[model samples]
Target: MPSPRPDVHPPVVTGIGVASGLGHGKDAFRQGLFEGRSVFALLARPGRQRGDGSPPFFGVEMPDPPSILPPRVERTAGLSGRAAVAVLDEAWREAGLDRVAPERIGLIVGGTNLMAREQFLSLRDYAERLDFLPPRHGHVFLDTDICGLCASQFPIRGFAHTIGAASASGAAAIVAAAEAVSSGRVDACIALGALQDVSALDLQGFRALGALGAGPVCRPMDRGHDGFLYGEACAALVVTRPELAGGTIYGRVLGAGFCADGCRGPEPNSDGQVRAAQDALADAGLAAADIDYVNAHATGTPSGDDAELETLRRLNLGHARVNATKSIIGHGLSAAGAVEAAAVLIQMREGLLHPVLHLETPLDEGFGWVRGGMAEHRIRHALKFSFGFGGSNIALVFGAPEGAAA
Candidate 1:
């Protein structure tokens, strides 16, 4: 990686990759958007083989494993690690960073359940035969050490950070990476967030909170909306100087802001969400009117969608389009922010916005729900918003380069 050019626009995403409930890679996700494919579906009870560890995991459908991953790596690292590797391989190949120094790059990954040791324990319970047990070797790299996995895989010398803000972790990681590059400490960075969705313990835990959807499908803002459909994914992006970027430039991450409402357990404050969005606009030297699209953090939950709608409507930005990808991919927790952010980037490049899947009921005034496969829009700037369980909220603004065609 090269040193950051302070005089330049600090960092730009030259390449992007995402292994989400929707799919993997930029083209695949963009295709899913254009085709109106909803990747959200029920987890297979005993579906795929254990590509990695002992316990079976559930996530969005993925293609065959990439050749880059060693068989031993797959057998040991589990789902989150595999997902991270998938994203990094796609990004590194797409970005063509043959000349970039690995040490100049940085890693900022976020997760609430990054291959938890408890997952293996749960696996041990389910399976009659156990291959690997919790190590007594005093290894520093535990399953919860998500940052260690990322740093070891990518080998970035700049600071590596891992956040645990439930659903909003991915967005926060991206914000932090942007700040790091802006400060001239690193030339480029990779921000990722992922989780395994099929852990019985995790599911039982959410059920304990009464947060799991009673029905099979997740319906955001629907009259019959029940609760969130739990899912897993890992999304990664290559953030670098705009001038050095190659390939199809999706969008530029202009600015980001985060805040907490001091609430607990899936509660959201519309006022706080509005404030966060406003703060992001101001940080980007943009006004609400400047934003063309708003990718909502609506989790298909009644209160969550309602609160997000209120905030989005209150902003009253002139003629901004609103769409929720959760309607397509379910709620991916920490990976939700990165996945949606990557979707916004693709739509910006394709000059079309994917409609919110399964949005039947009408939102309140000023907040329109998108329908159908894809809607054409001349979007220059867009906002990707994520609000988490503990009222942690983040709003990110992305736009094309100043002189680029919208």
Candidate 2:
């Protein structure tokens, strides 16, 4: 890929909002992330637990949505919908979007099949009386229901839609929003990684496929790595040109690269991952050595972690400090990319890197790993990786905000 034009300034991130197992809002997220907190527990939600009498799965579940949510949203939206609206409200306020023109704002929600639990329960409850199903179910069954909910609650009139790229949906949405802003399609855009409310069926499917872990903990990049522990998170980022930003700029979206492995399978492709990183660096007009930190997409799966490490080695980025956010937060699946992007920005702003949890022995220690505790590091440039099922791979480059300390 060719580099971006010299005169074109990359889109900047001005606001970030996150709802995760750590807690709601950016303050809780930042504190929990920097403190290396883990909240993994047995699946407790009504529809999340397996019904086969097997052992309960372990994962992180998000806290209840705040009571301040509008009554209509609270009553009508599903779990994922409520979380999306809550995060969007936080991001909108923090970005001062109340003052921005309603027609100039846009929304892009990332993720699909987000309301599986809600749908599953509804169907089971209405099986005896199908005609009595709630009217809202007609619309809420579609993933675009999140887009509609956010657009109605917020003043996003420029355009609104949802993007589904398996687990890479969040990063893909961010890249698309950056393009919209950089091309002047919208003054500012909200890229939301909507929560994936997995049903018992989803859990059983993953476990049967050997992709979901059942354990006391999720150990990403460790020699005892087995599989990923599901996590719930919804993250929103406000992207706009630096000059039009309404709040403190967190970082600049210097470049992004996305590609597919062409094979429809769960396995990751190392060559595709390498190409994505190389393309992102090229778009940023930088080399592998220029990256200061890396937020790896290590999901504790043996093959997935190995493939990413090999890609890092192939790109010669072993010198960059690397850590897995999933080790602390578990795997957010479709929301992982955007949530981890928020994690990267938070660490960059705080000048400290979070430690990986349960990484007793790294699969490969050639890379600089932030482990045991927080490490002081001012990141000037960083890379975030997000790979999804069915071969979607995304790489993003983020640079420190202008005038940031070195």
Name the runs in model 1 displaced over 4 angstroms: 1-10, 45-64, 116-123, 126-146, 196-198
Q: Extract clashing residue pairs from model 1.
A: 1-101
Candidate 2 stretches with Cα past 4 Å from truth are: 1-7
User: What is candidate 1's lDDT per residue for 1-406, written digit by digit as tens?
Assistant: 1122223474677777887655667777778777778665546544232445543332344554355556755555656677777887787667765446776787777766555444545566647644544453133234445566556666566667677678998888788777776776777777776654445566556656666665456777676676777666678877776666766566677777788888887677998788788778777778888887888887777777788777876888537888878777767788888878888887877788888777776555446456766888877888889888887888888887666753
lDDT of 2 by residue, 298-363 (tens): 999988998998999999987899999998888888788999999999898889999999888889
Q: Rate the local accuracy (lDDT) of all candidates.
A: 0.70, 0.89
**TM-score of model number 2:** 0.98
Estimated TM-score per prediction?
A: 0.87, 0.98
Report the CA-based lDDT of candidate 2 relative to the real structure: 0.89
